[model samples]
Target: MASGMILAGLGLATIGFGARFIIKQMPTMGQKLAEATKTFPKMDSKAFANSKYYKGGFEPKMNKREASLILGVSQTASQQKVRANYKKLMLLNHPDRGGSPYVSAKISEAKDLLDKN
Candidate 1:
């Protein structure tokens, strides 16, 4: 009888865990979770750009100056243009899309410099 009770509890626990996983994986639930958060941290754009993290063989070095050129803009590109270029480059080198984070971060840095200056 004790063994049967243990088996039943384990089965119930397994079912509960499976149900929880399915519910959490739902796209609506994920969106709701993102929106429900009131205070999420913002990405630090400047430091991200200046860091040497993004230079992973796609170029000899990654710098904001180079990024500005890649976006077909000058170092004097306006903040708005910098933002637009960053988005365009991100789409091409997004780590989640199989691109390197180091490259992405360099692109981010370049955009930040243009935005700040």
Candidate 2:
């Protein structure tokens, strides 16, 4: 009976610790969500749903980070690299090169938006 009581006490302590940790982390998590919502328009579900890129027949949704990944460039890459990556993707995805124009157009638009920001 004593051992069971000790185990129950330990479990309760662990639960309290976890609750405190979660509470402390909540503000940081909320701040991160707010920043993401403000900074990445692509992350907005409704806006993304209505985007030209989404309407263009892409199989999956692409986020800002995915856009950077697709172009083979850093999120902070300069305008020059952005242009270069766009050209590279154009070559790889150009309709004449047997690539889908829809995908190519999405890539081009992603690059353009990333460059502007």
Candidate 3:
């Protein structure tokens, strides 16, 4: 019957549309999965803490010039400016926020040296 043929055609069209929709969404789904995997890697916190790069308690000795250079401030920078810069750098380089421990250690050392001056 013509009506039966029309119904079959409609069903085929609906299935085709559904398939196209799924195919169109595949690339976006794949990209989201890739980004999720890349952003959150399997990082063991305990292992990172015990790593050689970790400098939790020990403070390294650094001169005023070295500290100034590390903090990206001039040798004549005021204490307030140094403290502000230190806080900014700490926020950026804190080990808990996906920053490297080694870099954070250097930043802390720079702050300590500047504070002592």
Candidate 4:
């Protein structure tokens, strides 16, 4: 009976310790969440929804990151490499050659955007 009482007391002490630790951490967790919300735009916002890079849908305006993905090159790829890759992609996806017009157009747009950067 004394052993059972001791075990119960130890369990209560452990729970109290855990509760205190969690309570102490709560403030920091809340602060980090606050900082994150301030640092990034909400995912549901129109800007985020329409983003070509983040949302994974192509847009009329090409972002550098999106352009890099479309061209299969690094974001910092040189203009010459961009052009070469563009040509290769166009050869495969150009509409006249039975490839996707949409894809071909995106490839061209990506090269142009990257060249300008």
lDDT ranking, best first: 4, 3, 2, 1
lDDT of 3 by residue, 12-68 (tens): 999999999999999999999999999985777765776655254433567787788
Better of 1 and 3 by lDDT: 3
Question: lDDT of each structure?
Answer: 0.77, 0.82, 0.85, 0.88
Clashing pairs in 2: none
Instruction: Kindly give the stretch of ten consecutive residues in candidate 4 with the minimal lDDT sum.
Output: 47-56
TM-score, cand. 3:
0.47
The window of 10 residues in a row where model 2 has the poorest summed lDDT is 50-59
Residue 77, candidate 3: C-alpha displacement in angstroms: 1.3
Clash pairs (backbone) in predicted model 1 = 49-109, 54-102
- State model 4's lDDT: 0.88
lDDT tens readout by residue for model 2, 4-33: 999999999999999999999999999999
Per-residue accuracy of model 4 over 1-117 as CA lDDT, tens digit each: 999999999999999999999999999999999999899955656756656564547866778988999898999999889999999999999899999988888888889889988
TM-score result, candidate 4: 0.50
Q: Of 2 and 3, which scores higher on lDDT?
A: 3
Give the number of the best model, judged by lDDT.
4
TM-score of each: 0.43, 0.45, 0.47, 0.50
Provide the lDDT at 78 for model 2: 93
